[model samples]
Target: SHYFPEMRALLNECQFNNCLHINEPGCAIKKALEEGRIHAERYISYWNILDSFDEKY
Candidate 1:
């Protein structure tokens, strides 16, 4: 959770406040990923770590 401040910052640049960064129109994070601004492995690693926390419960 503490690892993604840049992603969080990118959220602010999203056109929609409710953007989920997945299949949504005008999503900054998605756009960054598409533009190669944000590395795919880093994003996937963050999600993998976050998903592990969900499984702990």
Candidate 2:
């Protein structure tokens, strides 16, 4: 949430308790991104970080 304050509240709004906000179903953060409520650039950066983790591990 620190990375994206806009995602803080929506985090809990996700369908699952463990929603990673990556590509999970019923992800509130994704929904907001799709609806243009959240900035696309920030979402892109978030994806980049997650993708980097894949390379590290």
Q: Top lDDT: which candidate number?
A: 2
Every model's TM-score: 0.65, 0.85
**lDDT of model 1 at position 17:** 88
Question: Candidate 1's residue-wise lDDT over 1-57, tens digit each?
Answer: 235876877877888888756567888887888899888987787678867877997
lDDT value, residue 6 of candidate 1 = 61
Q: In angstroms, how far off is 11's CA in candidate 1? A: 1.0
| Poorest stretch of ten by lDDT in candidate 2 | 1-10
Best by TM-score: 2
Clashing pairs in 2: none
Clashes of 1: 0
RMSD of each: 2.7, 1.3
Report backbone clashes per prediction: 0, 0
As a whole number from 0 to 100, the lDDT of residue 35 in candidate 1 is 92
Q: How many steric clashes does model 2 contain? A: 0
